[model samples]
Target: MRASLPIERSLTAEQTTALGEFRARWAAVRRSTTPADRSAAEQAVRLAYHAAGLERPARIVWCDSPLALAGRVCRASHDDGGNVRSRLVDHVRRRVASLIERRVLRKVLVAVENSVNPADPLVTAVAEAVIRSVPEPSLSMLGHLRCTGLSWSGVLHAIIAPRGFASCAAGPHDLSWLGVYDYLREVLRLHAETEPLCGLMQLASSVGWLQPHARTCWLAERPNLLCGDARDRLHQADGPALRYPDGWSVWAWRGVEVPRWIIERRDQITLAAIDEQMDVQVRRCMIEIMTPECYVALGGATRIAEDETGILWRRNWLAADAWAAVEVINATPEPDGTRRHFFLQVPANLRTAREAVAWTYGMRAEAYAQLVQRT
Candidate 1:
C-alpha cells in the first residue's frame, strides 16, 4: 500500500551536475535521434558511466503485453466460431511452459484493460483466462487499469512474463508520459491515414466492443463538454498559459472515482533494467528487449521522419513532453495568450492468464522469448 518513494543515497553535487549535463547533451544530440538514436543514447550513457568511474547498472528484463494477445483473439472472435480465445489461452500456457523449459525464468506479468461501454463476454472470458494463469508462484498479477480514453481504446494493458515481483522499482519521473502519448498518437494517426480505422469500430462492436452500458451510464451522470459553461471552463483551462490542460485537471470530475483496481495497481510499467541511466524522478524497470534504441531514435531526433513501414510519423514526444510540462512551466499569462517557459520533463498494472503467440523470432532476448515458439 505504500506508494511513496523509498529513500536512497543522494548524488553528490558534482555527480548531480554531471547528470544534468548528460541529459542536456542527450536531448541536443538526440534532436535527430531515431531507433538508432535510442541505442546511441544507451551507448552514450554507458560511456559516461565509464568516464565518471561509476559501475554500470545491471540489466533486468520483464514482459507485459498480455492484453495485446487477447486483442488478437478478440479480433478473430467473429471467425471460425470465435474459438480463438480458447486457442489463444492454450498457446499462452504452452508458451509459459516453453519459456520455463528454456530456463528463461519462473514469474511472468499479465494485464487486462477495463471496458468503457458494457463489458463484453469475450473480454470477460479473456480476463478469466488471464486470472487463472496467475496464483501460482510462477505468475504475479501486478494490477490492471482503464485506458486514459485517448487512443488506446481497449488495447493499452499488458502482462509481464516469467513471473516474480520486479527486482527494481521505478519512480514517477523515471516515466516519459509524453513519450508514451506521442508514440501512441503518432502510431494511430499513421495507421489511420494509411490503412485507416475502416471497420475497426464495427468489428470491435460486433465482437462486444461497446458493451459497457454500465460504464456509459456512469459517465452520463457527469457534465457534458458542449455546454457553454463547460466550454468556458475548458477554454479558460486550455489557454496558452496551460499549454494543453493536464489530462487529470481537465478530465477530473467531482464525486467520481476510478475503481481501486484501476488506480491502485500501476501508473507506469517499463521493461528496461534498473540502472543509473534512469531518471531519479521516474519509475522504470529493466526489460530484456532492445526498445530504448527504437524509443531513443523515435523520441530524440527523427522529426517528421517515416517509420520503417514507410508511413509518415508525426508523433512528437517532445511536444507531448511540452504539454505535460505546462504545470511545470507555471506560466503567468499576459493580456495576450502567451507565456514564456523553461523546459521540464517527467513520467500499468494488470492481471490475467490471457496469452499471445509470436509470429517471428530473432528479436532481443525478451522479444526472442516472446516470439520463439509461435514462430
Candidate 2:
C-alpha cells in the first residue's frame, strides 16, 4: 500500500479519500478551546510512556492551563534542587527519538505531489490546511510582564515529543505537528512502526503541553478561550484573544501581539507611550486600537502637506522633537483594484510628502519624484 500510494500517483482516490475525511478531526484539535478531560489525557500520556518503554508515572499533576503548567515547570527546572530532577529526566522519554522521520515525510509528500487529481479542490483545500497548520510556536514571550510576539509535519511527529523537557526553560510547544502526522497515519495508514504513532495520535487528541518525569508527569489543560481573525491569526478586540483558566492570557490586534494595557487600559494609551515603543508593528496596533484620528488629535498633529505622493502630518512628540509621518496609498492595487492606505512615520524636518516619503528610503525628494512608480 505504501508503494501503491505513489506508483498509482495518489495516496487515496476520492473513493479512497484521505484528506477530506481526516481534516475535520485535526482542525478541531487545533482550534479546540475546551478544558482538558483529565482522565482521558492522563491515560493518553501513560499510553505514550508505555510506548516509549517507560513505566506509567506514579504521580499526575493537573494544571489549570498550559501556560500555568509551563511557568511552573520552567521555574522549577531552573532551581533544580541539587540535581534531583535531572536524575529523573535522564530515564524519561527523551530516549525515544526519531530515526525514520524523514523517510516517512518523504513518502507522504511524494504521494500528495504525484496524486492523480492534484488540482482537485478537495486536494488543494487539504494541502493548504495541512501545510498552514504546521505550528511554529514562539518561546521568547516569557520574560516581559508587558510582552508579546511549517509543511514538514511528519519529520517531527514520529517520536515522543518535548524531547528534552528537563532542559526547556522555554514554554509549551503545541501538539499541532502530532495532529498532522496522526491524521496522515489514520487516513492513509503510512507504514511506519505502529506503537509510537498510535501513542502520538492519542496525545494529539487529548492534551496541550506535557512534561514527564520518572514517577510524575505534568500536563496542561487546553485553553478555555481561543480566537482568530479572518486571516486566521490569534486575535480579538475587547480582551485577551487567547486565555486559559488560570488567567494566563495573550492580547493581540488583528495579528500583532500587544501589551494587555492596549485592551484593558485603552483610555490610557498615550502618544508618548506609542512613540516610545521600539517595535513598529506593536506601535501601529496601538494607534489602530486608539483610532488614527484620535491618536493624531491627541498628539496635536497638524497636516503639513498633501499631493499625489502622500499626505504628511507633524506634531510635537517630545519637548525637543517633532513627530512626522506620511499617509501614502499603496501603488499596487488589491485583488479588487482598491488601494490600501499606509501611514509611515518619517523625519520631522522633511518639508513635503515627497520629501518625507523619500527620506524613508535614504533618497532625496528630487530623486524620488523621477521614479516611474513606487512600491
Candidate 3:
C-alpha cells in the first residue's frame, strides 16, 4: 500500500506554475474533436501491453463509442442472442480481464491510487483541490463551480458509465489524474518508472475509451463533434452534444442527458411526455425546449399560486406524479417592445413562485425579496 513517492504538504511556487501549463495541454486533449489516430492508437496499445509484459493483441477492433464495447461486455455476461462476435469477445474478456488488471492497469493506474483509498493520506483531496481551482471547465470537470460565466447549468454533473466493463482507459479524460502525475513528477523530480506512464499517456491521447483483451483490443473512436457548455458539461441545444464518426450520438440539454426527441423533435416533447418523465431534471429540460409559455398555454398548466415575483403553475399526469413550475416575466423589454417570460422549475416543497425564483438564484425568499431581479 505504499505510494510511489511522498508528496509534500504544499505545492512549491514552480509546481503551482506548472499546473496551468498542464491544464491547458490536458484540456486540448479532452476537447479534441478529431477522429482517432488509428495507427498511433494501435501502436500505443501494443506498447502498453509490452510494457506490462503481456502479449500484444493480434488485432485492434475499431468501435464508434464505448457503448460498443459495453454492449459486447453485457452480452458476454448475459445472452448473446446467437451473436458470434459477442461470444468471442466474451470469451476473450473472461480469460484476460483479471490478467490485464493485475499486469497492465496496476502498473499504470498508480494515479488512481492502487486503491481508491490511497496509502498516502489526502491524495484524493489534494487532487480534487488542484483540479477544481482551475477556471477551465473540462479540466476541472469533476468538481462543482470550477468555471465562471455559467449561471447554474453544468455547475454540477454526474458521469454515468455502464457496468460490466473492467479496467480500461478513458482516452483524454484520463488526463484528469494523469496530468496530476505530470505535475507531481515535474514538481518533485521523482525517478519513477517512465515507460508505463508514457504508454498510458500515448494510449489516452490517440484514442477514445480502450479495452484490452487476449487477442484483440477494443478502441473507440473519438467523437468528431464533441462540445461542452461553459461549465464543461456535455451540452448541445441544437443537436447532439457529442457525435462519433459512425453516426452514434449522445444528446444533452444544459448538462443533463436526455432523449434525442427532447432536443430535436420539438413537437414530440409534449406536456404528457414531460409529466411521464420520472427524472425531474430531464423533465425540466423538456419544458425548457418546449418553452414554458407554450407548455402552459397548450398543455393546460393550472395556476397553483401567485406572488409579486411570479405565477406558479402545475400539471398532474394521468398515471404519474405532478409537475410544477414558476412563471416569471422579465422586467426588461426587448427592442420589439415585449417582455420575456421565464419558467423556473423548483423543488416540490416550494409553494410560491417567489420561493422558486429565489431558489434559482440560490437564496432565501426573504433575502431575494429585498432586491430586484432583471430576469
Candidate 4:
C-alpha cells in the first residue's frame, strides 16, 4: 500500500510531479532485497519528509517498519547532535547582553546632558547640623532602629525624654526616673553649643520622635504651635498611638515645626550643671546627633531637579521599610516672601541607606556621562 502525503494545502502541478517521483524512488528503495540499500533509502525518505515540513506522529513506534525507517533517517541528519543548537543559543544571549549595555549607555548620556549642580545652602546647613549633632555610633544605630518598623521620630523622642519608671510599676521591669533626669543632662551637654533643648525636643515631638503623652501635652497646651494645622487634622482623623519597646510611643501626626522659643533661646542655654548630673541614662540608651559622614555612610543619595524657578537638590535615604526624603529648593520664593533656610527633615533606616549610597557611587560615571550629554 502507498503512504499518503502529509501536505496541508493543494500542491501545484510541478510539486505534484516531484512528489510522485519521490514516492516512486521510495518504493524502489523499499523493494531492495539488501538491508543496507533499504536502510539508505529509508533515511533519504525521512529527510525529504522533514524538508517538506511534514510533522511526525505524536506517538512514534521506533520498532514499527515505516516509523523506524523515519527515525533512522532523522537520526542520520543529526549525527553531531545538539552542538549547533547550543552555539546558536549562546550567540543570541551575547547579542542580548550587548544590546542592554548599549541602551544603558545611551540613558546615562541623556541624563548627563540634562544635569545641573545640586548644591544648595539648605542642604549644606542640614548636612552640617547633622554632622555636629549626631555621633558616629548613634548614626549607625539609626538603621537598626528603623528595622523595628517604628517611627524614627518616636524612637528619637523616647531616647531623649526622661524615663518614666513610675509608669512601668505594674510591669515585671524595675526602673528609676533618676536615669531619665541623668539622660537629659547628657543630652544637654551633647547639644550645648549647637542646638537648644526646646528646639530639639520640639523638633522630635513634631517629627513623631516624642512619646504619646508628651506629644499630646504639646499639642493640647500649645495649640498655637506651628503644627497646629497638623494637630487639628490628626485630631479630626482620631488615630491611635503606636507603642515601641523601652516605653517609647508616638502618634500618627508627623509634621515639621520650628518653635519660636528655640529660635530665640538657641544661643542662650547653658550646660554648666549637666556634668554633675551626668549618669548612666546616656550610656544605657542610643542617642546621638546625625553627622555628614554618618549620613553618607547610612546611604544618603542625592539628585538634581530643575523647574521654571531654578534647580533643586533632592536627597533621599532609606530606613527600614520607609524612605526619608528632602528637597532643597533653589532660591525659590516661599509664601512668606522669604528665602528658605537649610534644614534636614526625617531620618531613615540603615540597609536602605547603605544600598542607596552604593547605587549612587556605582552609577556615578554613567550619571555624569548622562548629565554631560544633556548640556
Q: Each prediction's Cα lDDT score?
A: 0.23, 0.57, 0.58, 0.26
In candidate 4, position 330 carries an lDDT of: 35
Deviation (Å) of 115 in candidate 2:
12
Give the best candidate by lDDT.
3
- Across 17-115, the per-residue lDDT of candidate 1 in tens digits comes to 443443333222212111122333334333323332334323211112222222222222111121111122223234333432332112211000011
Residue-wise C-alpha lDDT for candidate 3, range 112-223, written one tens digit per residue: 2322212321222222222332223221223212211233443322122212232222334333445544443554453243335555566667776665544556688776
Q: What are the models' TM-scores?
A: 0.14, 0.61, 0.66, 0.15
State which candidate, 1 or 3, has the greater lDDT.
3
Top candidate on TM-score is 3
- Candidate 3: RMSD over Cα atoms? 14.3
How big is the RMSD of model 4? Answer: 35.4
lDDT of 2 by residue, 202-227 (tens): 66567755655545577777677766
Better of 1 and 2 by lDDT: 2
